[model samples]
Target: MEVDELDFLASSTLYRRKDFLETDEAAKSHPNRNYYYRKNADVDRLIEACTTKLKNNNDNTRALFIRASSYVKKGQLEEAIADYSKLLLVTPDDIDALYQRGTTYEKVGNVDSAIADFTTVLQLNPNHVKAAYARGACQNLKGDFIEAIEDYTVALERDSQRSVSSPKFHARKKDLQSAQAYGGNTSGVPQDAAKDNLGTVERGMSGLSLERQDSMLGQAGSSAAELRDSNGHFAAGSSAAEPRDITGTSASAPGASDPQGAEFYHARGFAHRKRNDYRAAIQDYTRAIELDPKHFKALFNRGFSHDKIGEYELAIKDYTQSLEVDPRNGYAFYNRGITHDRKGDYHKAVDDFSRAIEIDPKNADFYHNRGFSHRKKGNFSLAVSDYTTAIQLNPSHCRAYYNRAFSYDRMQKYHEAVADYTKALEIEPDNATAFHNRGSLYERIGRLQEALSDFGKAIELDPRSALSFNARGLLLERLGRIDEAASDFNRALSLEPNSATFLRNRGLCHRNRGSYQEAVRDFGQVLAQSPKDFATLSNRGYAHRKLGNYSEAIHDYGMAINLSPDSVRLYNNRGYCHAKLGRYADAIGDYSKVLELDPNNIHAHHNRGISSDKMGEFERAIKDFTAVLKLDPYNANAYFNRGSAYDSLGDFDKAILDYTRALDLDMAQGGDGSSQNAKQM
Candidate 1:
């Protein structure tokens, strides 16, 4: 199952008035410092004021910094980089300016430049924890997992030295572990995560279950300012400048103020979740909650982590808590619904999904998942309706189409199912599961050639798909392509050696091709796995009879009959075995059972007549043969056999008359004299 991570929005970084006053005497005397600190100040007016300051003193560091931040807020990343460059010219070793520029570079998709800036910051101040973490994030984005791990470790070590039990320390440790878990590869990370320059530090974790589609951490809804803000530290004069201990106290005391506080912990938890370390992420989120009980992001992410680890009840609790903090958050409701689905509580899942839809009606995943829950509850019509709505909402939603097709199939609407599958394939042409499902549908509807083609395509798309191979084999066997069918079955068995369905299919193929001994071997293997399998037992009995092992065949038939007492075919088969072994009385008894079960069984009557004749009961043999003739009036063998019984009773004229009538009937049917003389039991 593919999962999508929800986007985690981090607070923006804002420079405080004190930062300029402490750095430069010119900034201390500036009259507009108060204006800079005002919330909701017009960004263009700030940029204009900075420009006027720069015109008077071209090297004013304060003006350069303010204008750069203004450009970032305005989404002019290139201009922000230019302002940062000018600041570096005036104060070439300014660590803060270097860090901010690097983040700007990252926002602009210039990852190499960002890494260079971060590296310079680290070179200037080896103890810079934010620099190390930022560099690690850049490295991770670049797929340099080993280097990312080293940087994360450095950050973790430095942070631990500052405060061993701080939320930031745990976050750094989780990041290091996450980098190590990647093992220098990006296999578990989503491809889009690396390509999305705006989310460099918050790549989503992979390997979530199907219910979590669209649940991976993303940068989808964030504006440019938010993205840039996420890259930098929290606002100046916050707890970030003075590190806090685990007790949430001041740095001067036993504990210190955490720079980003609960928000930083929440961000780290997102990182942990992205790495698929749910337990580690949960701890971080719990810490965030401890710091700020009303932190909805922390609560929601904790729930998501819990759900990932299969703690359904706990997940629901966390989601419920998050909703309490922000009642209108549809994602919380949607994820809670997913948890309910995981717990097999379709009613609750539907309720949650409905609430989510009420909050945000345009979300296709909400409808799609609701449809899935409906399907699980055997409400095929409702499932289809929900899936159709999902499809309408998102025309490219391949899973919605595929799942709707399954519902159609359950409802026995084969044509509708086929059309939906076709649409799904159009959306995801490489989906092997879709092809395999469609092929099975085609086979059910008797579109043999199309079924074969679809199966072949599925196998071509996914060479390891044992189901595709087995399905193709069954179709081939039905078409009398025995050798090709056997090869497919062999391939399927090689992929899945213990598949009962594959074994049975190959066994039947072997039997059809007259390899009775091989058929017996395959059936034995199947029965070994499932001792009471009636089909395998019955099939094995037929193979034994073909091999002239009459007693073994009779034993298998008896066992099969024991499992299925009303099986007339099993009784008839056992009767044939008995007759082959010259056990005429036993054969007669078995045949009588078949007749009792199915009174019109012509083969049973004929076989019983032969058994009666072998026991020298001429009158009884004549009666049984008469019954066979009554059922099948044109049976030449019955007429000849009954005539022989009459001869045995010394009724020569009647015997001669019956024999002549049998000969005339055989001639009229274009049968050779050999067929007329041959007596079949």
Candidate 2:
């Protein structure tokens, strides 16, 4: 190095060789002394050094081939094709030139031209494996499955291990196999039946097995058959073989072994999916995506796989990605909706379903699932609308009718509810729920015989239906058949375990049968589920009082009151329990609260009056008696209680008047009214 250059190299920021190489002194070394080369310590400057060598003299075929390869690498494919063609014209049977030109033709999507070039290479050297592989791909594209398979078999036989082992090597072999399984061309598939994978030999589909085509041909070669096309050129060199754009020159794909204007990876990926090889399918899909990132189908298929394998988050992301490319894809929306549903995000599921429906309203499944999401969210009205739309689109959709009926039943639109259930039954003759629900409506409307018949049908459809058995037990109990009610309740319990409502209802049957212990057990379980269940609490408290457990009864009554202090029936029962416990003041307090909430509660007033009289609250007793009388003027108990209250107050005239009134009302009804009046009081 020069002294000044060394000084500059030391002074001017020499982080590495580059710091020194960029100096004016380094630039002065040679015409091609690039800092980039200097930093690497290479005396050669690639292109510039080559120009120096060419300054001597050069017409070497090897050099020509090397330059052609360089041009090919630089995407100047036309220049590369010209160079290879000129070199081959001189060295006609040069295997390297032939192979290079063959591959280059294949790259340009001129598969027919490629096949001719490879044919010449194979003719000169019959064992050319690459030529065979390339010819196979071209043949496959041209709908010659037999020839393609033959070429592939030859290639595999000649070179079981590819010297130039590239992705194309494996890719071409796989596509050839697929072509053999299905038909050579895509359009050869028969959509009327099952399709073959590649097109070589067909397995049974739609009860027909296609005959396999002959693998290899004789010496004729396809070129002899190619020249008669409408384009007036050899089939391999025809416009169909090469992509002929609006411009005079043909457009070529730079990638090798793939077709010019066609997406071979996409076709191969679909082929793999058809063969149920998901991994290979994914590989091809990935390659297709690398080639064309916006391929929505590949994205969707990959996403669907993500869903099938419980990778829901990944599936959702992929579906979202597909939607970015194809905003109106209903299938993508529908699939995303499914993922959202799996995640239990009902609102998002519904929104996705809505968008999918907006894009393709004819899809009944989307509406049905959306309806289910709405039903889960407790939007029964909206659920009914979605379900109805599903039904309207597909009348034979049994689930839609059944779900709509459930919504109708919840809304208390009984007649419309019955119609929907009936429609569901018409579609599915053995529908047990339909019969059971219809029976419930019948029982509610006082049609006992019809209700029984429907219940019988339900039981026949589903012999183990707990709901049907429970309903029948309730009906039998109401009809004064206590023994029959107990048997049905027992059967219902056998069918259903740990059902709070079933337990509570069966407890009522037990109570009627005087099995108070069992009744209390059942009601206790129901109370476990809903700790504040006033009805079950009150019922169990009554059972306790009946069993002479007054203290326990009072405790239960207090719990019931805490839950529902405004329930008149609950208060009346609690007051009865308190009265049983001899806590007259407590009984009176509970009765007062019930009356305050329900001013016209007859039982509350009657019970409170009795409790007041017991506590020596004569005025309060008299007031309760008058309230009862207002509710029912003929109440004998009210008259009796008021007479007693008046006597206690030391008002003999009012007491005698009350006694007379009680006797007269009781007598005027001819003994039946007195018992009835006693019942009323």
In model 2, what is the error at residue 495, expressed in angstroms? 3.0
Give candidate 2's error at residue 405 in angstroms: 4.0
lDDT of 2 by residue, 150-219 (tens): 6655765665555446785676566434322211111222221111121232211000001111111011
Model 1: lDDT to the true structure: 0.70
TM-score, each model?
0.75, 0.52
RMSD of 2: 22.4
lDDT of the structure predicted as candidate 2: 0.62
User: What is candidate 1's lDDT per residue for 1-681, written digit by digit as tens?
Assistant: 001100001112345667667654544555665523223335676677678777888888766776776676677878888998999998999876787787778766687998999899899989777677667667655656567556655765776586668786676556433222211111122222211111211111111111243322111122222311111111101000000001111101111112245644554555556566779879878987998898766777788788767898998999899779778777677778877877889899889889989987997777877787788788989989998998899998776787788779879998999998899889779867677778777878889899889889989988987767877887888888989999999998999899776788789889999999999999999899988888889999999999999898999999999999999989888988888888989989999999989999999989899888888998998998999889889988899899988988999998998898788888888877442542446
Global lDDT of each candidate? 0.70, 0.62
Q: What are the runs in model 2 whose C-alpha is more than 4 Å off?
A: 1-314, 324-329, 341-362, 366-395, 404-417, 437-451, 471-485, 512-514, 592-609, 612-635, 638-665, 669-681
Compute the lDDT of residue 66 as modeled in candidate 1.
65
